[model samples]
Target chain A: MGDSNVTRRSGKNQLLDLYLTFAKIGATTIGGGYAMLPVLQDEIVTKRGWATESEIMDYYAIGQCTPGIIAVNTSTFIGYRKAGILGGVLATLGFVTPSIIIITIIAFFLQNFAEYPVVQHAFNGIRACVCVLILDAVLKLGKKALTDYRCVLIFVAVLAAALFTPLSPVLFVILAGVAGVILMPRKKPEKTGDEKASDAGGKEGTS
Target chain B: MILLRLFWEFFKTGLFAVGGGLATLPFLYDMSARTGWFTTEEIADLLAVSESTPGAIGINMSTYAGVHTFGVIGGIIATLGLICPSIIVIIIISNVLKKFQDSKLVQKIFYGLRPASLGLIGAAGLGVAKIALLKTDVFQESGVLAQLFDWKCIILAVCIFFVYRKLKHSPIFYILAAAAVGIIFKL
Candidate 1:
């Protein structure tokens, strides 16, 4: 829908634009997810007019809900909307290019120096910060995820299972999806019984 | 063969790690536990590096793990493996379902997935806590209660946590500051 300007431009130029824009965003943003959002909005929405703000939010929503890294997912969605499959692939490649280059260099050096006393000491501190950052993420995510008691129940159950059992996290994700579909509609019926009931029943029948 | 395994593992990670970059931690921990490709401590190191660095945290971590395991080429393979799912899924959604985000079924599945992913992340946080806050090896060897905790790390973690909560600086700032503290105190 927003490809009018893109159509006027040559395919090669548009693709290069998509790749370079995302590569710049990827290189500049320090943290992923929300941190990347403002920069993404600036470059893709404000600067380039590739997508509207609302559309970017939609992309983010889907990006969060679906699998894979959110930044890459959003980049792909925007790129696809801008051009096509080639656009999507190029954008994703552009997004991760900086990461590959930077991390490969760091990993190359870190591996060699990893055993050194000073590097080890620095890593010890960094590890503590990792714990802190993860703790912050859990709190933020928990606020969003644990909305009701059902969600709280799932959270506790999954946490217990994760710690104690040998079950794969992949299994947990799938099971939780099933559980959500089964559990959520029951809550909806309290507000509008007939409509939701039939809707759920119809969906269940189709599947 | 190792590279293939790395690809497959990260592919699955990309496929199932719902929510965001941090969600990949549990899968990485599982990968280490199963394959011994790297240690939990290494994950912590990589996490720090990933957080401070540019680009997506998931891509950075995967690249780091791949490089740590197999070399630079391994990093490339693991990264490609991780993004393959996103490419396929996003393209399908873009071509097929314009209203996929508004679908009730999609919302329902995520309703369940969100908390479950949180639990997985919480468990991963505990894993990092173990590596960051405790000295299991010293405890195992000495069998002393006092030896169980690395008090300095515990103090460092507590201080960093509180300081972070109060200051609200970017994660990189705190991480870099903590590294300075570590070097100064030889933690």
Candidate 2:
């Protein structure tokens, strides 16, 4: 009984630590899920050692392929891995609570603020910058996505399809998956799923 | 009833919005056409707001959309609805997906998804570029070369794009700088 109680206390402490860490992350992650990459390396991998670097990349890919927000999904995956269902719940709540509170406050005043000139102008200037931010993100992701000559074909085809056609991006994503299964050269099977490829530059861990 | 519908709509969005945040743009457009809860122009604002804010852009926009149409309760319900799929899906995957995690097939699919996602982001970026730089309405209205684009916005966007290369700070920094410029220039 004493041992069980001790375990419970430590577990609670870990959960609390997890919550505080993610709360700060959710609050300050300016560029969204991808932005959380560097933070995760710092907090989760380097600081906490809760997950290995490759696992985070794998989880990121999983987060992307699965439904829901990638940030929420990845956080949940980490939370669940660390502390089971409740851990998952607390971590998510922690990650999103800032957004909820802030967005709620913004929503409360936004109706009134929407028509104000300074607010509108600020939004205008910010919108132009938002475009640049998106461009930056695309360029970064492009480096990862456009890794090879054969991949170039898939990249161009997908880009043109997304740009001009009526085809849904979702459909393109699915089709690309199929193409990947078929077209991407089948690398020799690594003996273990979790085996860290030593040559990997850890680019996935970087922002 | 509207809350329920908002929940259902966002639930569908969360279920299918593969890729990332901007991947939900098409779904948001669909919601606009089908429900008329928010207009296209309002969605543009939501996009900007979502991009600028902390947290996941997809959830922030959905929460904002719900609040815009339905209020605080709507925001809660919409957020819960959107994340439910993720929680459930991750729970299942975490438990059962270990064996299949390393298959060549899975790797290939992700191999495709990474660039496809980039391509999709590029397309979305172009859409934002149109909204930010081009005054398409003016082009349609006046058919004048000078009136085709907002020169100030274009210049500002170019400046931001280049400046971003040098000052790779947090997004909030650039956003605030632009806001300051906006207030100073009344952009």
Candidate 3:
């Protein structure tokens, strides 16, 4: 009974710590979740040592599959890993609170204020800049994604389909997923003794 | 009845909108087609406003749709409904995550998901490109080239690209700069 109580208390404390950490992440990180990647990496991996780099990458991957926001999904998974359901709840709430407050305030003014000429002009300019930001994200993500020939082919096919055909984006995504499953190279079996010996000899001089 | 229906509709949207907030676009477009609660033009406008605002695009669009459909109450219902799944799933996953943390199958599932997510992001990039580069009814109709291409937008895109590359500045800086240019150029 005493041990169980200690466990519960420790879990609660961990939840609180996770909430505070995520709240700081939400408040300070600018330019949305993608920009928050390095900070999340630093806090979760480098500092806390909660998850490794590959594990964080896995979170990013699964986060994309699920709904809401990538950052929220990541935070939820990490927080949950650390504590439990309560921790996940607290972490998500902390992440979204800022966005909620900001949006509500903007919504209040948006209807009437968006009509103003200056405001309209400002939005136009912002829209233009947003195109740049989106493009930058694409370029960066593309370099990471399109490392091999298969990925490059998929990229080209998707781009061509998007540009030329009236294909639905959703359909395209499903197709690409199918293609990835079908086309991704299988891991090869371990080489025979001779090949292993040659590989070791090749590496010996370089090292 | 109305509130329940509103909640269910948003719940469905949230459940299916994989990839991210922008993936909600096609679903919302389908909703507009079916219901006519809102027009395509309004949907486009909603996309613009939602993307520009300071919240998750999915939530903002849900709020817009809810407000359009059933006013303030609808907005709250829709928001709650949309978020419900995430809350529930996260809670459940949180409970079981530790046991499955090192599972190979789970790892492989996420590995497959990375490419899928990249594909969706690519598709979204294309959608935004269509809005940014293509001149629709927003510009006057003329020849095919004139109808499709907006030189002004292209110029702005190029300028912003170079500025972003050289300065490596924040998005807010670009937003402010673009606002200034819009006022000066009347674009």
Q: Give the candidate number with the greatest DockQ.
A: 2
Regions of model 2 farther than 4 Å from truth = A1-66, A69-71, A74-88, A187-207, B1-74, B94-96
DockQ for every prediction shown: 0.42, 0.46, 0.29
Going through the candidates in order, the fraction of native interface contacts each one reproduces equals 0.76, 0.66, 0.32
| Per-residue lDDT over B13-65 for candidate 3, one digit per residue giving the tens place of the 0 to 100 score | 87777655766788889888887768988778776666555445676677777
Instruction: State how far residue B41 of model 2 sits from its true place (Å).
Output: 11
Runs in model 1 deviating more than 4 A are: A1-95, A106-111, A185-207, B1-82, B93-98
lDDT of 2 at A99: 80
**Residue lDDT tens for model 1, A131-191:** 7676675675465447689889888888899889986566777787789788885556334
lDDT tens digits, residue span A1-207, model 3: 356698877776777788877776654333334434545644665567766544554565566656655666777788777666777777766665554554455555576444567766655565556656665765655554454687677767766776678755556555665675566555621222234335434433342
**What fraction of the reference structure's interface contacts does model 2 contain?**
0.66
Better of 2 and 3 by lDDT: 2
Chain A structural similarity (TM-score) per candidate? 0.52, 0.63, 0.55
Model 1, A74: alpha-carbon shift in Å? Answer: 7.6
Model 1 docking category: acceptable
Comparing 1 and 3 on lDDT, the stronger one: 1
Best by lDDT: 1
